[model samples]
Target chain A: MEKTTHVTSELNINNIKSFLEDIESFIFDCDGVLWRADEAVENAAQTIAFLREQGKKVIFLTNNSTKTRNDFLHKIKSFGIDCNIDEVFSSSYGAQVYLSKINFQQKLFMIGEKGLEEELRPLGLEIIKNFEKTNDGIDNVQHIEPDHSIGAVIIGMDTSYTYQKGVYAHKLLAENPNILFIATNTDPSYPVKNGKSLPGAGSIVTMIATSTGRKPNAIMGKPEQLLLDLILESHSLNRAKTCVVGDRMDTDILFGVRGNTKTLLVYTGVTKKEELPSFEYQPQYDTRTIGDLFTLFQKL
Target chain B: MEKTTHVTSELNINNIKSFLEDIESFIFDCDGVLWRADEAVENAAQTIAFLREQGKKVIFLTNNSTKTRNDFLHKIKSFGIDCNIDEVFSSSYGAQVYLSKINFQQKLFMIGEKGLEEELRPLGLEIIKNFEKTNDGIDNVQHIEPDHSIGAVIIGMDTSYTYQKGVYAHKLLAENPNILFIATNTDPSYPVKNGKSLPGAGSIVTMIATSTGRKPNAIMGKPEQLLLDLILESHSLNRAKTCVVGDRMDTDILFGVRGNTKTLLVYTGVTKKEELPSFEYQPQYDTRTIGDLFTLFQKL
Candidate 1:
């Protein structure tokens, strides 16, 4: 990989080329820029192929905590893109890393689905269901009381949401306000097929936070510096070389900008073209569309 | 009713007695103190009966926008309490009063349900329903756009929520940014049969405010002082002799304290027993429970 250092206060075409030269590793956001609503961007496969040919490693990063790395890899491969499970990083995995580093010892009360449980199980974390039900005699469980032995409460999207879950989370949160309240991401809505959408884990997290007078300790996803730091540490790469590409400015572009990496704002995602000027912080490169990625790669 | 005034900063039994003696009109809050999880308070019926015998005027004041005055009266009567529709005041009703006073001429783009419509329709206000169905491509209406001619956008809880509504609201908000965004209440959650619930209008209203970067022009509900002013204006009652009795310190008691009415905190609502001392503005009377209201009346 070519090593070049270029810095400009604003986005320019030359800086984009300089970024590609210096960065041996590329982190691409999946939801909006690569594939939106169920359809992959026209140049997604070509861009990935060009990156592989250039001897540059590509990692698919997603804040969608609903899917596992293997699941994501399978989905990407089906879209005519080649990626292994190890090349994909999800917020659920990042959350697991966060939990392992903390000194929580209580039974983990999770407000998430199977993907989250799959991530936390290997850490020897005990899952406690219905803390309120167990305490109120509605259900029988060994751990009825909340004490130091209770580890932490993790929140994420659960399609099978119930009032009991909220009640339990509220009670556990109230008991130990210091207990870890970790959420996967802060995205309020997730894109669905047929132009429909569902409230993401962040909405539930907000509800819990508002009910209890506490905020999450850490959000293990994009826009949070922790995940970027972890990726950098694992790859043994400096921030100057890595280029972050995504569709949303608030989350993806923000991650790159704040992480001191070259940021590319692709037009194939959640954010619209008209909303760019209003942003306080602009991205390093503003491509008309992600289809231009192949043209830029050819020029480079 | 006694017209005794005790101007003492320190709270004592003598002052509490004096304050209680001066209470001719009583304002009660719904949800928590009146009922907990669909169960009416044990003394609710008897207390209302005793107040009626004393020939004291009573009003049921609530920040809950889900029900109309008739709905509340019916619900209260179902719970074995005698109450009139005229004696109930809601934030929706307050919004109607505010809108009528402003003399807005154009049709209203309402983001609320039946209760809100019922309150606004009597004032000859035209309710714009097409904003709610923008996704269906029903663009027959000439004034589809939310402009200066489109008087205001009234926001309240609507079970029929959609992204299309959000988009239309955003469009109107972006165009007129000055167009009124009136929210019914700011309570983040409402007590349900199970526990505290989400999808409250407060969350939706907050989302719109955060997205548009503008606070609503006014919140016509408890704690806003608008509703209190309306109550006093309609009933021709003096704030000095009016006692606001409710379970929530933040909403009911805060209103009373700010409006210069005698505030009473009943320990049967959103606030717990231990949380009273932490409040910056204290209530005049802190009863152990709503049952103590009868005892307070007896003492007076």
Candidate 2:
């Protein structure tokens, strides 16, 4: 394996305070950074509080499309962290930002649950008056009629994902070739309750892409600059002062790098300590856990 | 897009006779060639009857893993074509063929319906006493406890496929990295009815593969010689004298090409005439429909 090309700096007491002082905004990725599954990461809540106390912009920018912005707020709040609805930015929220970008007028055919719908509905985007009521008794056998008004197909993490939903999305995309196809995020699987994981929207997005023989026209998640752009545009945070702390390198670190923001990698989630060199994108600073940052700020 | 590298010859009155004369065994893809979703092609039954009269050993080889060999036999028989149980080969059959190759002792964790199970159950391969009874009430949130007895996980097309199934498959493959991950076939979509298509086993297979971060150890379906190998070994058919006819290039034609059998492309299914020149794999003979062949053999 090729060695890491960039000089990967390990955060220490000597270099930590000075490097941290430059960062005004802290964009943390959830699931691994602040919490994993339902449990909050130890001292991670304290670290966020400490940053906020120091007048730093703490925004939870996540590629996980499973929850709405409000749901995300509740989860973080339950963890004893004070969070506003505005501070939460999910891949699901990217649909609103992306749809408004194209000035999309027609209805959207979605392959996601309430999280995706909740985010998009706020933008006055019609969701095509879909499933649950439509696909009541019959689950997979019910054939969804093609709605001519559908202009785009947006896919995100769906717990109730079925073959019927996939096939319908495939049919709509196939017939209406010009429709905007956008993927919320493409994280294969997110870390769940145990060491186990659930399939992420990326898996579903890729499955459709594989079958449809077409990739998303625009990816609305991290590493693609959409979610970060949502954060930047909404918060009006200076890119130079924004530091993205995340668990995965492909999404988190890469997202920060693409947005011209500083990146910090934590090891409590997907990306590990030794696996850092193997990744193409190197972070500016990396620590074993977010609690390590808590220790530094505690001493200060 | 670049033009086709090889000269793709169209089957005509002169070339068709010569091409038809060279082949002894006829391997037909059922979905597009013989039938399309419970309806038989216009003169496809007559074509099969005509070929059989000319002493051609007819075989229906399909990448569709949704049906067992017996189910396939019944479907063809229902279409007024003579077909033996041995002549019908499906991608699901590859599970039995592949298991016997590995001499797989432990139980299998399957992600398919009765057709896939029915095929493997006959092989005396224990199917881990799977779902329907277990995941009865809860659909997506069913927490399936892992069975350590599982030695492999095989997937095929399933209408009742859920997100829970995808997550479980991802979990199993993740925990048991050494498990034999065999995909029946990886055709993205298959035509069902009303010019629309259903998501193929390939989509589900690809979904799990994406989430698991691993590809199938062996793909049992078309383009891979496993299904064709099963047909060749069981029937003792000569590969050189065999001609494989189908609608799709990636699966059907590529399967024949890889198996060292003559490939004939028909436009009755997924592959179109104009799209043939763009495909990487070129067939030996191209016809508008299988009926064109019936016309040639009708005179004989």
**TM-score against native, each model:** 0.68, 0.89
In candidate 2, what are the lDDT values of residues B1-300, reduced to their tens digit? Answer: 222345668887678778878999999998888888778888888888889888999998877776778878888999899888888888888788778877888888888877888889866867853454333222335366567667888888877777777766777788788877889888887665677776778889999998889999988888888788778888898999999999888888888777778889899888888887677768888888888888865665
**Candidate 2 chain A, run of 10 with poorest lDDT:** A133-142
- For candidate 1 chain B, the 10 contiguous residues with the lowest summed lDDT are B134-143
User: Chain B alone: TM-score in each candidate?
Assistant: 0.87, 0.91
Candidate 2's error at B50, in angstroms?
3.7
For residue B91, model 2's alpha carbon misses the true position, in angstroms, by: 1.3
Candidate 1: DockQ? 0.10
Regions of model 2 farther than 4 Å from truth: A1-5, A38-42, A125-142, A297-300, B1-6, B37-43, B128-142, B297-300
**Candidate 1, after superposition: displacement of residue A123 in Å?**
3.1
> What does candidate 2's lDDT look like per residue over A66-130, in tens digits?
67888888888888888998999888888888888878888888888777788898778678535
Predicted candidate 1 versus true structure: per-residue lDDT over B1-300, tens digit per residue:
122243213324455455546788888887777777679887888778787787677888988776778888888888788898878899998888898888776778777767888888888867874443432211221123454466677777654544345545645665575687888987765555455344456755764564455678889888889988888888988888888888887788788878888877777777776786667777777676666656655665
| Candidate 1 C-alpha lDDT tens digits along A1-300 | 112232223334555566557778889998777787669888888888877888888888999787677778888888899888777888989987877777555578887767778887778868875445533112222133454456577887655444446555666775676677888987765556544345557766765676565789889887888888888887777788888888898899888888888777877777776897667777767776666756665765
Each candidate's fnat, in order?
A: 0.02, 0.63
- The TM-score, computed over Cα atoms with residue i paired to residue i, of candidate 1 is 0.68
Q: Is the docking of candidate 1 incorrect, acceptable, medium or high quality?
A: incorrect
Residue B33's lDDT in candidate 1: 70
| Candidate 2: residue A53 Cα off by (Å) | 4.1
Candidate 1 ranges with C-alpha deviation above 4 Å: A1-16, A103-106, A128-150, A194-196, A291-293, B1-24, B30-56, B62-221, B224-241, B257-300
